[model samples]
Target: MTDLLARHRAVLPSWMPLYYAEPIEIVSGSGRRVTDAAGRIYLDFFGGVLTTMVGYDVPEVREAVERQLRSGVAHTSTLYLIRQQVELAEKIARVSGIPDARVFFTNSGTEANEAALLVATNYRRSNQVLAVRNSYHGRSYAAMGVTGNRGWSASTLNPLNVSYLHSGDRLRGLFRHLSDADHIEAAAEDLREVLATQTAGEVACLIAEPIQGVGGFVHAPDGLFAALHKVLDERGILFISDEVQTGWGRTGDHFWGYQAHGVTPDLLTFAKGIGNGFALAGVVGRAEVLDSVEAVSFSTFGGNPISTAAGNAVLDYVLEHDLQANARRVGAILRDGLRAAAGRYPIVAEVRGRGLMLAVEFVRPGTVEPDPAVTTRVFEECRARGLLVGKGGLYGNAVRMGPPLTLTEDEAREGLEILVASIATVSAGEAVACGVSA
Candidate 1:
């Protein structure tokens, strides 16, 4: 290990996951590419865990932050009026699809979800939360409590009573044999059963991601959440869509992932993209629901001028450039390419995800058993070929790719080629060793 790696191991928590056997320190980036400490350029398919939405060094975002820096004002507590914060909140509310929407900004997705949970439990006067199996929210106590993936959930102790429901993963669920429509009905029925038995029927909310991010881009069938929402509605339970990974039109089919199910959440939490790598996240909900938080609360640096300025620029760029449409178009190309690769590679058990947020699952040939060995091999191969991706799922046997929404068709094809080549190399059982290159 390098001296820096040794220092990282010494200081950082052991549970903090790193990508490679020998991790590369990314130094700088432009567009969809990053250069590591050793001056090796790699196509960044993961986009810093989907936070770098527009791309690295985007001119508009840079100029906006630079302008804010020139103003000689940066931090002002949320107690004071901030123009950029208000404007950004307005934009988010407008796009949030919640009627009479209100927004509360936070510094990260974990805080945003925590705020959402606070609003939800307070509004409904209950602490029981419904979550989906194989789902991931965030790492904080409340967030981790709702998270269903065992790998991400660090402990069994939880702040709230959380009941896990079928997440609609067709590939690996009790209803995997059923058709899409039947699967939705089954999952909805499962939700009803869970609610009836698990709680006292006074649940705070059902928190879900339209697409499970850290769980290997697992997607519930379309309209599944809507079906479950009908049950929650009768019980007067709120719906909180965790859009930390699915927002900002990253899914391509809709600006918000919940829209694909034709449902509007009572509350939504977002991060990882709006500020294009800046620490900005928030909860958008109905005015009444947000107002339910009676205590005076404030975020010290949540909506500070600099982060809000970056957010405004990112949103403007997303709208003006129509990156959502680009994500749809190029993402289709990448998805088709991956599916085709799956056909060719026996280890590629599945290819899934919507738009740019995609994943390829590695499994034993002709079986659904996860092949994490092959997954690790393919990951190292991609790294050796100057491509950066991500890994997740309960078994850690999937490769995830969520390039910037601004990824061009050519870049998509290039990254796809590298990915397929790496998979092929691993599938061939090459004896190549893993680790960072010198």
Candidate 2:
């Protein structure tokens, strides 16, 4: 393990800081758990950042990939379609309900989002895009332009055609800023106001995460998405939902996060759980929007045999095992456990999320100020106790927990107990005191 780290440091590029991790070197992983090089097993609450939905190194997926590997991995462009790719695309479209949705595959979330942006731009023939503040799309040139994370320099990277507004405010402002005062109507007026500012037949796309996973797991307000769709209808603009984190049944009740809002996006992109841990992603769009950009779309390695196999296997495992329903049940248990823990500790600020995508926010006692130190302590203590969770949010003060949907109820309870003990210790500014010691 030491040799592996040394070799990586000696040969790898310097951009490694882009990914966040602790000092431990993970050696292998399996159902709801990962083993480090030191032979210590850690319960994984973050689930490969919510990617390994069915759990790590799933045998069925591995077998499918091995079978595909015997033939070939990469295919010759979309020039020759494989049966698996076609079958997978059809399955995704049928599940997504985008009306004859066409699939444009990619290798990562950013590329999926990039493809969605291109479809939106070409279909509308407009350059301007609207996105919410703190929203994270991806870290590509165009995708980053629409991302609202202040740390990533998206604002300075591409200054034009990208407007930042609060999540709810983005939709509301877009309605009100585009039209005159008399035409404006309550909160819905903001959308009209912004759309009016763009040139006639302009404003290409409006992209947002169904649940802002990276941006604090912030759920869009009820009725807000449907209202946004109505405004988009009025202006003939495209609506894109970036489902990289919230897709593939991690959100509990629905397979796709947007389904929770009872709204369908003109363009939707997916990654993460589609391939479980393998490199796979895709952009699916309404037939009308997709057909408009059909000629312009092409990728060398997208939808290759191996990736398609992994994706199909993941879908099969998720459905066969009823992981979505498990996510709902386990998520409720986890949330209830966290709330109970919070009641026993005053430093806990709030707990928010749905299904398996949950977060426990920490704040300084007696004030609402974010407590990053407390969060760090909680994370470190959990890691020391053989449980691995993640931290995120604009303030870096929320303990993010999105374990694999395959997590057993017993395992989930054990992890929660460790977390509760850690939080209690951290919030009190001391370690647990054994009764025998005193």
Candidate 3:
């Protein structure tokens, strides 16, 4: 499978997204490319859903893991102090903007989110969390309870008290066509009204993804969150920033996605890119929220020596080499190339996102209705040409790509050429199918 499946035991557990009729089994990778079982090498733009962050076969990460493995012991429980875990936690705290931050390691983003929810609910004495429309947090019942994207949500039987808001998605929502300032004001008013009418004034927290990942990379205008937070702040409702896809400078302009806005979240959850393919995730929150729990807490596998070692190496590589700046420079080039290509096709609805985290949505030629058929063709065409991208968004009409932050200028152009050509091919095919001249 190419694409990761979601929210069920019967479905193939979400691995890599598979758009091809015959799914390719990726056996190995180097740099920004992967090799399938058939020995077909292809440029990997999706980065295993943006998890293989620093590229394949990075020596620093490999060597760090090897050193930790050779240390003669690996499974010491969190009962004992682990030097690597402590060191990595210290580094993360420094990078995390949370004041007096306390870190709790988890094996994945879902667990990190669960931990954040636990702390927030405990501290605020409530389970009522405000979630934005089209937001995705995780797959656990607790996590899924707060999730707003119906595409990934499986059941409505939830334990947490969550209310949906219309502030996250701008492209398809009521305020999409409005100007930035007007959109901000309108959405903020909606939030204020929802708070006044929906639940008691003392809500637990508002959990959000700065850029909705599974919901098609949708985000509101700048300052929209700042305005929404003002209402939350007035009621003492905490804010949880889910940076699972938008953290670690993947968005180019900022290290954390929330940084793009002017305010800081009371708590934050992160995963996907921190370990560069290694299983590492955690929650960073203010001391009061974290220390509020009276019970002794520990995760047997979270922050295990091996994962933390890889995390240290990955963080070092990102900072020492300045890959964030690289993402900005190369992302601009990719966006420009995509914008120019979009001008040539009528089926392309929009090309949106920041830095390497970009998406292209497809729609019927003459209407706003999503065209998943054309989107599938474009995805398949890119694969036929040995370019591996991603397929996502609510209606499955958006193609997603986030090449490794280390992608070179030439590689960016190469992927862009293949992507644009695939769209051209698909668009022409659709044109001919409709009895129109291409």
Candidate 4:
């Protein structure tokens, strides 16, 4: 290990994982690529786990932060009214789509979800919460409790009485054999059962990721949440859309991933991709839900001037540049190329996701069992070819590709070629080891 890595291991929590076996120390980044400490450049497909929305070193965001630094204090502790924070809140409330939407800023996705849960449980007067299987909200005491991915069970800090609803993974769910409409119906019924038999009393809320992020970019049917929300609505159960990864047009079809489901959430939590690379995240909800917090509330580091300034610029850049439409166009190119490649390899069980958020799920050569070994090999091979992708899955066997929304057609093709070669190399080697063609 390098000195920096050795120091990192010595200081950082061991549970906090690194990507590669020999982790690259990223020293600089610009556009859609980053340069390692050794000065070798690599196309950054993961976008810092989907936090870098536009790209690294974008002038607009950098200048915005610079101006904020030159103008005033870095933080105001939310006790005093901060102009940038107010401006950002106004913008988010306007676009959040919730009726009479209100915004509360937090420092990260974990804090955002925690805030959302706090308001929800207080408003509903219940600690019982429901979530979907294979879902990942965030990492906090309450957020971790709602997470349903078997790989990440409720941690020791879990406090909420959370019950999972149903598996949302169409490829590996119990309803995998059903059609989309049928699967939606079955999942809705499962929620009804959870409410009837599982929950002790009035449930607080149901939190879900429209696209399961850390659970390997898994997706449910487009209208799945819409149906589930209908059931929750009847029971006075609030619905929280965990859009930390699927928000801001990353999913292509809609500005928010929940829109694809055709129902608006009562409360929505977001974090990643909002400030590009800055630490900005928040919860937007109905006036009543957010206003339910009667006590004094404010985050010390949440609405700092620097991060809010950067957040404003990011929203402007995404809208002015029409990056959402760009994500659609570019995402299609990447998905098509991957799908075509998957057709050639039985190890690739599915190519999933929308817009710039895409994933390739690997399995045993002739079966549906997850093959994390091959997935890790693909990750290493992609790095060798100057490409950086992310690894995730219920079983750690999915290669998630969430490049910057500004990814161009040529970049998509270029990255796709490298990924295909890496997958091909790994598949051929696996075949040789197994004494059969893959």
Please report, as a residue range, the 10-residue window in candidate 2 with the lowest summed lDDT.
Answer: 429-438
Candidate 3 structure quality by residue, lDDT tens digits, 236-272: 8999999999988888998888988888888999898
Which clashing pairs does model 1 show?
none
User: What TM-score does each of the candidates earn?
Assistant: 0.97, 0.89, 0.95, 0.98
* Predicted candidate 1, C-alpha RMSD: 3.2
RMSD of 3: 2.9
What total of clashing residue pairs does each candidate reach?
0, 21, 8, 0
How high a TM-score does candidate 3 get? Answer: 0.95
Please rank every candidate by TM-score, starting with the best. Answer: 4, 1, 3, 2
Instruction: Please give, for residues 81-155, the per-residue lDDT of candidate 2 as tens digits.
Output: 678889999989988879978888899998998888888888888778888776888888888888887765444
Which regions in candidate 3 have their CA more than 4 angstroms from the true location? 1-17
- Roughly what TM-score does model 4 have, to 2 decimal places? 0.98
Order the candidates by lDDT, highest first.
Answer: 1, 4, 3, 2
Can you tell me which runs of candidate 1 are displaced by over 4 Å?
430-438
Q: What is the lDDT of residue 209 in candidate 3?
A: 87
Q: For model 4, how does the per-residue alpha-carbon lDDT over 178-271 read when each residue is reduced to its tens digit?
A: 9999999999988888888888869999898888899888888889988998898888999999999999989888889999989999999989
In model 2, what lDDT does residue 363 have? 79
Error of 2 at 192 (Å): 3.2
Candidate 1 residues 1-438, lDDT tens each?
399999999999998878898888988999999999999999999999999999999999999999999999988789899999999999999999999999999999999999999999999988999998999988899999999998888888888999999866656778889988998888888888897788885899999989999899998889988998999899899999999999989999889999999999999999999989999999999999999988888899998999999999999999999888998999999999999878877788889999889999998777898988889989899999989999988799999999999999999999989999998888766323423221
